[model samples]
Target: MGLGWIRRRTGHRAAKNQPGDLDMEALIPDHFLCPISLDLMKDPVTLSSGITYDRQSIDTWLEGGNFTCPVTNQVLRSFDQIPNHSLRKMIQEWCTENKRYGIERVPTPRVPVMPNEVSEILFSLAGSARNLDHQGCFECVRRIKNWAAESERNKRCILENGAASVLSAAFDSFAGDCGKKNAIVCEELLSALSWMLPAFDEESHKYLGSKASLHCMVWFLKETDDLSVKQNSLLALKQLLSCDDHTKHAEALAEIGGVNDILFKLIREKISPAITKASLMVVFYLISSSSSAGEKIKLSFLEMGLVSVLLEMLVDSERGVSERALAVIDSLCDCDEGREKAYADALTIPVLVKKILRISEMATEHSISAIWKLCKCASRQEERVLVEALQVGTFQKLLLVLQVRCGDDHTKEKTNELLKLLNPYRAGLECIESVDFKSIRRSF
Candidate 1:
């Protein structure tokens, strides 16, 4: 009877003290809570406004392009954040006392990198690059990359300290060097540049767009077996070509012999979905930048068998890859040579028809646009293309697209035109059936 009574009492106490049954917020001191997150303060820091918050929460608020305090709503006089060591210690003590309540003590936060430290690192990198000290450059760049990965605050500090300019200068300085050590240094520099891309200034963009820098990227893309090196190279090229003078850059890329072939090879290899997408974007940007360049590049791409590669990409690629592939195809079909190449490929029309209303609105739009060009612009091959499209259920798909309003006004217009082109033959099944695939093959 005594044992039974003790067991009943213990069960009641355990149930009463259950963590889920307790109001943890009520137990914690109000001042111990971060104003931003309303949770226990970990790594508390004080703003210039005399308001305290968790370091991470405040860092996030500042990093989100805000120049004012979250609580006070006053414009910040400076970006300096002072560590609230006293409050952090108090919170830790409270957590230690509440260990039985499942509270864990927050670990001490590491001090964020300051602007001066970033400046020193950049100086070291510049000096190493100037002296042709590949080893020193590699070490400095690796450290910078580590800092970039540490925290958003570190990244902000690094960028503010002019890391992008220094890195680009180093990259341009080492442009002519070719050796294992230099290659490794170059790769590290590119990786660091990739991290700083979002913060690249006008000067950095100019340096990256220069002839030597562009060639360096092309060299990495063509020679390096490292996946990361190739990826970073593609990313840099994509950024450079995305600027306002993209046509000039595109022409520059073309002047770098074998760039088109290199990009096509990357796409054909299917190394990784990201690399493939970047390669495709570079190609798309290259051809779509200027009409003259576009026509020349499209013709060159067609001769190199770009249409077949795009058609194959459409089969099982991710939505983004599929959308880009369709976009490229749409761009390609703008030229007569592009349309002929697309028509010559047996998979082209069927792939375009299959893609409509299946992938995305943009994909549907691009697909419809390409089909319009192939069927409407083929001149002598127009009838044969329409017959082939109808045979492959293009007529029915077009009608479905219209009923569902799958694309934009332009797509709707193309859809209606294609329907009109195929409607007459839709009733004449024997005329479509009698169309010779052999004759269509010869028309190409």
Candidate 2:
């Protein structure tokens, strides 16, 4: 039985009350419903334009990039949501009257976070915190994180009120003293900082500038066995290192030690697919950021035995993993040392030839680029590297790449250059003649 039955039987506004056949939802007045959620208001709050809504609904709407009042369609002057005490009291009274229909009063929501509250949370996180203090700081940070997650307004409040500086200070405090430090607090703080990184704009650089923070990241990667801490640290490091100014800090990153070792070790360990992808993204950003730092990054990767590991990843079935591996090889092969190492591998030439058009367009470009670099050496100095390419059917692969109509223009251009370079030496490769090299030679 419901209010619909009663309305159908009576069909009049002055009909007697049918409490025995009513729904709690039917008893709630339309004005007491939130426009956004279309539900009975709980903790009703008023916006700047005098439109009222449930606090949770409006906060979620504001956080999701909505700035206008849902009912009036007027642009909001501010995000402030003042409590509608009178309306809340009326809603509560109505719910009480309908208590027999299973209506329960809404509990008062924890006070909506304000700017000063964010500041207080940060203030508690600073200094030499130990034991119970660390636990208390973690709890405070958890509260701020919860509030920020609630909506975009809280995120703005936290960032505008010095959240970044406080996080950096907390990082310093945690790193400065060890007697009270634990992985739980450290991971939570780093994750919170990571969440806020995107919202900080240029201030992100200042927070990440701390050597202690950088060292803490490296320590997390190298020393911690906790999976979550490692992932958060990697994400935070990726966020920081992907910036354009990484060139200025590349030298310092290199000097901090263990960076290359941990990256390669994680790659070889295959901890998880996400961790590996993130590690590859970090390496790609670092190597591709600047030409001046490329050699250093290449040298470190080589010292950490990255060539063999990357060669293994190149064959992975996952396209993203293999594509990133090829990209890394392309960047690593930019230097003479990287070239020497890659050229020495018997599988390197064959794998590069095999990947010509079998993978993505980007992978095709990277593969051709790697072969181009290798053949440049052979064409200029008639080095044995050219002989190795010919031995592994490199020219045959290039001919296939040239014939594929679906390949990108960049791959076609590189293929043409490689064919031209090899044309001069076609007569010397008489050892392997499975295809009509002369026919392919004429097309080139």
Candidate 3:
């Protein structure tokens, strides 16, 4: 919104669209599309004349703040008053179609799938000046969603056949289309699938759980990174974990591995805490979703020695990595016996100790939850080791954490019981104080 935020457009269109970026045709419609404004819509600023759209004026009028339009020298006080009728029409249309989807969810008859040409037309329309027409924009969004749903069903088949061009185009178009842009669609899709799953005929399973489609699910889970997307993807994957759908979990995990270089950059380099939280959840999915995935996450964790870095981040004045670390540890706790043994043999103490230490630094409920989980997992043998490890300062760290972070009375009670074991304690005192006197009576 600020003039300073705008840069004089530089690179050639070819450079901008080289392989990894949004394509021009996919970005917006060519006709009536202003070359200078890109996706924001072109100038004169207002849909009509006389009282023109003023970016800073709108911003100031709203009294939120002020901003200048990038193209026209106009003031905008808020996005609400930017008189773009076409954009409004598109948005209204989108909202209406959304309602239709809601109605269908409530028990409407199934609509016939729209023709492929209609989908192409809708994709093109979304790119054009027609994109500003409220009704037209909304229709464009509707067509995009329907097409995405159909394409998603087809994605796995295409992937298995190795139809790279078709798959890539579908992936790009789906990401560019706003109807498919947010997490809501995935959430709805997974929710509907849950009802249908129990009664799924093999044909339905073949389509929905196809190796290609399952891979796409992983792709969406890892690539999208929106919070809602992250949460729903985990839910869908959790559902899949219980079914035969996870026969491909290892392959899905491998496809996900292709993207960890990006995550490594995100972890070591700067990333916003919100994005970091989702990143950690996705990582947890990678590990906890299957034993094979657990192997992959463990290897990556060791390669990165993420625990040390996460600890350093735990002490960060601004942000910390305690949640992510806890997730990794949780996955380790569940892995198959061989892998679990490797974890206990190699990592159990170091990772848990670091997380316990971090509990003191974090003010969030999440950190406390992580410590409680660690307490639940430690064997009495591991507990003794942990107690020995704590001799330098560990018990105090957990005590301070419990003082603030304990979420429930039961967790606090568990903590007290564990502490009494670790301390210099009278052995019979714990049994005497037990909720059941059976242990004390047996002792007697």
Candidate 4:
């Protein structure tokens, strides 16, 4: 039979049979299949637009720059994927019945940790840690960490229930001991604490203030060969460094034993993008915090060739990554050493100029600010830099910025300052003009 004819006949038969369709092959309901993949959904997740699809398919769709419902074409308010647990159970049940037809049964999915469960775990952990119940605390910390690792929501719960205080106290009790048991327990607690640090801000001061917690996290970053543990430690340390109010914490982060070296190695090795980005953020916070310590941190990053790393990241296709990379560059360029390093890279000026209108407004703000810093702080040794900017069509890009209103007031002000600076350097008092301005304006 022709495939089209068969499909039409089957549709008629299906409509006639309705819910009574009992043929084994066609028994699988239409709703069981993902709209995108046309297969039984192993893990169904519902979109904000009220459409359901297999998790892998929907993740692929969203990752492919889609933000609308596939079935309804409605605009989505959020990208959050909610698990359709009831649909998943039905699909699994159907798969089980069709095993004779060679259909494999879907495995049960892991249940995300609930907030109440996390609260129970946190309460037990706090009570155990307080009563010096090392074994009890160890078990509780392990459970809490597993829960936090399972979901972002659970991580927030872990933080809100005083996980930080509990973990810090546990680490302090065990940090001084050199036995294998103590070290193992502390490592477990530190791993758990790291996952909660990003969301929980209540214990930032207390947790970071503890010498034991700092030492343990630093030790984990420096001594551990496991990338997962290192990634967690980096995240925990980043929160501490970012949230600490005292200059001592900032200075400690900047001068911590092997901190910069480890960060440099991670960035240079490109182990994992997540790890590198976390390390970069830690360095950014460390450098951007204290004015007295800023120069030292800036010099540290410059010496580590961060300018080259950041310039490369600007070309990344992902806008979020590019935006963050630019933010670090902006922080680094606040000092003369950093500005000189940035200007020295051959790609720096052109990349900054190109990204002005192409990236997000925040990115544009940082790019313009970095360029202005370079131009505003230009020295006698780098007089040709301005000429280079003009030669590379920086003036045309700035004019485009002025015309398009691609960003906020800060962006406009920076562009104006850069143009004012360049005006003086223009040859023969001539106003720079671009032939494509009219077309470019229309596109913008």
Best candidate per lDDT, number? 1
* TM-score (C-alpha, index-matched) for candidate 2: 0.69
By descending TM-score, how would the candidates be arranged? 1, 2, 4, 3
- Model 4 misplaced regions, further than 4 Å: 1-120, 127-134, 146-160, 175-183, 244-246, 312-318, 426-444
lDDT of 4 at 235: 77
Candidate 1, backbone clash total: 0
Better of 3 and 4 by lDDT: 4
lDDT of 3 by residue, 1-444 (tens): 121111222245534545333222222223223323333232213422224332333333334443544445466444433344554344344334433222111121122233455445435543532233334434444444454465333323222332222222222223233244423333333433432334433344444444444555556555665555544444444444445655455345456445555544555553556445555555555555545655775566556555444445544523334556555544544434323342344344434444443333332233333344454455655554444434434455456547555445654665665565556532332221123122221210
Candidate 1 at residue 37, lDDT? Answer: 86
Instruction: Name the lDDT value of residue 415 in candidate 3.
Output: 61
Who is ahead in lDDT, 1 or 2?
1
1-444 in candidate 4: lDDT tens per residue? 111100112244444655343333525677877899887778798888888998778867877898888999998999877999999988788767655444567887666566677678767876876666778987888788677666555665567667677677666667655134466676777677665565555554565456666666677777777788778777777776676464567776665567777777776676777887787777778788766776787787799898998788677646766777888888888887888898789988878876776766777788889889898898888877787777767787787788777778878888999998887677743334354343564442
The predicted structure with the larger TM-score, 1 or 4, is 1
Put down candidate 2 lDDT per residue, 1-444, tens digits, no spaces: 122211112213323355444432334577788878877788789999999989878878887898798888999998888999888888788667755455666665556678878877777766424333677777878887898887666777788888876775566557543223555566677878877766555555655656766777778888878777788777777776777676655555666777888888888888987788778877876776665565677777887778778887776647777788888888888877788888767778778866666666677788889888877764344366666676667777777666654357876887888888777666667244454343432321
C-alpha TM-score for every candidate = 0.84, 0.69, 0.37, 0.67
Residue pair clashes in candidate 1: none
- Model 1 C-alpha RMSD vs. true structure (Å) is 8.1
Sliding window of 10 residues with minimal summed lDDT for model 4: 1-10
lDDT per residue as tens, model 1, 224-314: 8999999999988888788777788888888888888999999999999999999999999988877476567878898999989999989
lDDT of 2 at 92: 82
Go through the candidates in order and give each one's C-alpha lDDT. Answer: 0.81, 0.71, 0.42, 0.73
